[model samples]
Structures are given as C-alpha cells and as structure tokens.
Target: MTSGWVFEEAAIVFVSILAGIIFFYISSPSVKHEKKQQLEEGTSLIINFVLFIWAGKIVLNIHIFVTDPLAVLAYPSDAHAFYMAVLLLLVNIVYKATRKQMYVGTVLSALVPIFLGSAFLYEFIEAVWNDNTMSWSHMGLLFILLILFLIRYEQIRPFTMTALIFTIWSLGQTILTFILPYTTLYGYMMSLWFLILVFTISLIALIYNKRKVT
Candidate 1:
C-alpha cells in the first residue's frame, strides 16, 4: 500500500512538471522569441533542484542509504530537506552564473514561471485526487500568479515580477497555515517557518533587484 501511494505521488509530480514545461514551451513563442533558452534552462534547473532535495533526503538518512539504497529511495523525503535544498539551489545557480558570466535575472525569469506552474498543478492534483482541502489556498495564490504572468510576460522586468510572485505566494501560504495547520505542500506537512523564510528571501531579492540597474 505504501509503495503504491509513493508511486502515485511520484506520478502526480511527473505529470505536473511535464504540464508546466509544456506551458513554458508554448508561452515562449507567444512573446516573439524574446526569452532565449528559458524553457531549456528552466527544465535543467528544475532537475537540479529535485536532485538537490533528494541528496538532502539521503544525507539525513545516510545509514539507510548505506545499507539499503533501494529502501532509502522508497522512503518519503522529510519536509526539512526542502529548506536546505532551496538554499543550495540558489547557491548553485549563483555559482554557475558567475562562472559562465550568465545573467542571474534571466535564469530566474525562466525558473519562476515553470516552478509556479508545476506548483499550481501539484496543489490542484492533491486537492482533487487526495481530497486535500488545504491545497485550495495554495492553488488560489498560484492561479493569481499565473494570471499575472500572462499579463506581464511581455514587459516583465526580470526578477521583479518573479520575486514579487514568490513573495506573494509564500506570504499567502504562511497565513493559510495558521488557519489550517494540517496544510501540506508538495505532500509534506506545511511549515510556517519555511513559508516565512521563503517570503523574506524573495522580498529581499525583489527589493535588491528592483534597486539594482539592469
């Protein structure tokens, strides 16, 4: 039963990501090819982000990984791994950007939309398939983000809109957690602190980028 549940969850995640990528791919041309490599780079970053989270999960359960790697892989990852993985993902992106002389804002512009789309689909699926009412709050916020993206994709100022949406989503989720403590994000029990941290980080980035020219 547990294995089946895990498989089901994995399937949902895969489908959500694929849908997000398709959306990203389609939307790119609508902008008259303004954003280059957005889809490809976004997909690559998403893969890296997942691998980082998986690595964090394994590190937290090194004994299991050493003994029965298959069992470790089958186990559900802890929610805490997300926090570490997010920081690591940022670091990795910055490191690559500096080394390759790439613009961080471009990466963020691509990454945010794909990530937002996947998140919305993930929450929407959970709400329908798992009967998780707590996902409604997240889905609503994500929907707003999607609509805003549609409106602003053409004139989007790189990190400004992306970080703004992140701030909004995290803030909304943080409030929702108080009203619904059983709230789950990405199939794990929601963490209020995590939401707050994400909010702070995004807000700071938004302010920083808005102030910085180009």
Candidate 2:
C-alpha cells in the first residue's frame, strides 16, 4: 500500500528471517557439542538472546497500549533486541565452528573481524530503520567481542591486540565526550567503562599466563 506500510512489512520480514537463521544455526547438529560446552561454561548467550527478543516484544506491546512520550522510547527496543540477538548468534556460530581448532589464536583472528563487522552492520541498520542517531549502546557489540576474546585468552594472542584497540577506542571516545557534551556522550562513557572492563580481564589473563610460564 503506502511507503510506510512497505517499510514496516520489510522490517518484519527481515526480523523473521534473522530469527529463523538463529534457530537453525544454533540447533544444527554440527555445533550441537559446542553448544553443550558453552551452556556449561555459565555464559548465557542464548538465554540473553531470547530475553532480549521477549523484552522487545513486551516493550512494543506496552508502547502500543499506553500513550506517553516515554512509550515511544520503545521504538528502538526492537533495534536493541535485534542487535543483541545478531551478536550472540554470530559469536555462538563462530565459536562452535572453530572449537575444534588446536590454537585459540586462529579462532580469535577469524572471529574478531566477523564480530566487529556484525556490530557495525547492526548500528547501520539502526541508523537506517529506527533512528538516524547512533547511540553508544551499539558499542555493546564490541563488549561482546571482548568477552569472547577473553574467554579464550589462553589460546589467543590477538586477544591482547583486540584489547589494545578497544582501549584506544574507549579512551578516544572519553576524550571526545569531554569536548562535546551531548546525550551521545553517555555512549562514550559506556564505551570507556567497557574498555576498562576489557583491560581488567586482559590484565588477569596476562598475569595468569606469566605465572604459568614461570
């Protein structure tokens, strides 16, 4: 019918396709063993994905049922949910596919760009569909990348390199935020926090590695 209706329909179809992809990939027999190990590792990536989807749906319903400016914030709810869902899916798929590798460095090298690219794509999608404004929450994608890096730190030197990049990005954002005070500055602050967390994890990994070497 109208352009607006067309866009809405397309968005719905895209989301449906994404959900199907996640379901099929996660349920695949090839990755079934890795999924079991990941689940046992206390990393609730799948659970978080499901929760984000449920939260987005609930927020959308609340927005529709209520009449408030606050409700409109839910307009980006689906964007956030989709971002996380795609991220977790990507990480799970990569880890499962690469788990058989003897060296963790190979896994890190293979996954880092894929993970970062996925984050960029999610932000690009948000810019196109939800709001033209990109927020720091999108940086959560980087945090996911860092988490994966740290989890396999013993086997990956690239984790150190990625941590360095993350640190620089975080510090740069913090500096820019000081120069420009805006709502988006919050995103910079969050990025700084994420970077700090990454650094902390990296430090721990380094210390552990050194101790073992000694």
Candidate 3:
C-alpha cells in the first residue's frame, strides 16, 4: 500500500526535477534568439546546480543515507542544503568561466533569474502544501512577478531581468515584514542582503556596459 511518506518523497523529487527543467528552459539565451552556445551553457548550469543539490544532501547526511537509502529521498532539504548548493554552483561556474575565458557577467546574469524562478515555485508549492498562511501573501506577489518575468523574458537580458525581479521581490518582502504581524525580522535579513547584492551587481554591470559602449 502506498503511504503518505511515499507520496511526499515523490512530490519532492518531482518538484526538484521540475525546477531544474524550468530553470533550463527560461534561462536559455536562445529562447530569445541568442547564440546556441548560450543554450548549451544554460543547460550545463542547471545540471550542475541540480547535481550539487543532490551531492550536498548526500554529503550532509551520509550516515543516514548509508543506513537507509530511502531516508535520503524522504528527507527534505533545509537552508544548509541550499547554501551548499549555491556555493558549489558558484565554484563550478567560476572554474569553468575562468578556464574557458567566458564572460563572467553573462554567466552570473543568467543564473540569478533561474535561482529566483526556481525558488518562487518551490516556496509556493511548499506553502500551499503545508497551509502556511504567513507565506501566502508573499508567494502571491511572487507569482505575479513570475508572470511578469515570463511576459518579458525574451525582451531583456538575464541580468537586468534578474535585478528587476529581485528588486521587486525585496520590496514585497519588506512590505510583508512590516505589515504581517507574524513576520520575523530575523528571517528577512537575508532578503535585504540579497537586495543589496542585486542592486550592487546591476549597477556595476550597467556601468561596465556603458563604458564598453563609449
């Protein structure tokens, strides 16, 4: 007989795969008529991100996974898993970009949207599944921003779009932090930090592009 845990495990796997595929598709530079190399690079980027997530999970709970392989599938990843995944992904990207003499700005710009879109969908699913009312408003705004992203995906470069989306998301988060009584300030410090990072990167990219044009 099928059990709840089995379904939960299946759902988790499905969501993870779906997130990867979505990232690959939406972030494909050719989707908006960019070069074929961009599509290939985007695919590699998403694949590396997924692989790192799985690897991080295994590395963090090797004992448990070794004892019960099923536990690895059943256990949900936490913030540490996310942090590890990002760290590994950054390392991979940096190594490849440096070795190949690829454009660092282009690579990073492509990554940010994929990250935000994947996070939005995953968080929305979890919030709905767990009946977390506190997250509903934030997720709702995220959905709208995601829709806007889709509508304009082909029109803008990934970095500019990523900056726009992150800025909007950060604004929404700030509003939620203030208006929602249950919102925790400690929980939102990361969002603020991310906002600053996005703004800084976007500003630098703009300045660099302007200098290159002139």
The stretch of ten residues in a row with the least summed lDDT in candidate 1 is 28-37
Residue-level lDDT of model 3, residues 20-66, one tens digit each, is: 45665655555454444554565577777767777888889999998
**Per-residue CA lDDT of candidate 1, range 1-214, in tens?**
7778788988998898888877777665346454656665777788888898889988888888998998878877778777668788889888889798567766777777777788889999988888988788878888998998888877867678878888988888887877776566677775788788889999998888878855
TM-score of each: 0.90, 0.36, 0.60
lDDT of each: 0.79, 0.46, 0.61
The true-versus-predicted C-alpha distance at residue 121 of model 2, in Å, is 3.8
Model number with the top TM-score: 1
The stretch of ten residues in a row with the least summed lDDT in candidate 2 is: 182-191
lDDT of 1 at 72: 76
Q: Of the pair 2 and 3, which is ahead by TM-score?
A: 3
Residue pairs in clash, model 2 = none
lDDT of 2 by residue, 1-214 (tens): 3545545644644453344334333432335665344333312443445565545545546656376644443333344445445455656646755776234443344334433444444445555665646444445535554455445544546545455445544554455445545212111123444445545655665566556656
Best of the two (1, 3) by lDDT: 1
